[model samples]
Target: MAWIHLLIASIFEVVFALGTNATDGFTKFWPSVVTLVAAAAGVYFLSLALRTLDVSVGYTIWTGVGSVGTVTLGTIIFDEELNAGKVLAFVLIIGGVLGLKLADRKSGTTQPAEPEPAPVSV
Candidate 1:
């Protein structure tokens, strides 16, 4: 469930990034509105996912996936460059995200356990 929330957040992050480009320096009202709304939603969902997932793992995956989505979509929508270097970088980012997820699953701890309370001196 937390992973699902993180995926939603990453989608929103991509939407927010692409929408920002359409905002025309925020002069375009509708695009600016969309960008702002997407940004808010992304953060909201991310916070929800963090309740169960470790921040280091969750946040890294969020940004990594979001970046790949943004670049991939940007090229198709805006006719931006998609060079081999960018493709290679995307592959690495995706590998890292997958590795983190696998590590988390194997460890059986999505988040860090709470520290034990110290004994109080009488």
Candidate 2:
């Protein structure tokens, strides 16, 4: 399913992000290689999701997943600051993503276009 691809893409986005950080400006060989591979995989999966999902909705959700995952991982692995505001923002982002999903399901991907007006008299 498209959702599965999106999920994988999002996870890979996190992997590549962390791998890039670990690469030390690509000076490290193995980590840099891993980072590049992860980046490619992420894009590939994202492309799969985009085949059926709306671009705006799919891309936003993808970025949201990657962002939330990256930040959470940063807190756990890199010991980044985990503050109240950051937590609240993360929750809001998740809520927005969920809302978008529900809306897409109810309304479908593309909205109906308005009918063209009749030609005016000269």
Whole-model alpha-carbon lDDT for candidate 2: 0.90
Q: Which has the greatest TM-score?
A: 1
> Distance from true position, residue 19, model 1, in Å?
0.5
lDDT of each: 0.95, 0.90
**Clash pairs (backbone) in predicted model 1:** none
Candidate 1 residue-wise lDDT, 15-101, digit = tens: 999999999999999999999999999999999899889899999999999999999999999999999999999999999999999
For candidate 2, write residues 25-61 as lDDT tens digits.
9999999999999999999999888887888888899
- Screening candidate 2 with a backbone cut-off below 3 angstroms (N, C-alpha, C), the clashing residue pairs are none
Q: Give the 10-residue window scoring lowest on summed lDDT in candidate 1.
A: 107-116
Taking all chains together, each candidate's TM-score versus the true structure is 0.90, 0.87
Q: How big is the positional error of residue 89 in model 2, measured in Å on the Cα after superposition? A: 1.1
Positional deviation of 118 in candidate 2, in angstroms? Answer: 38
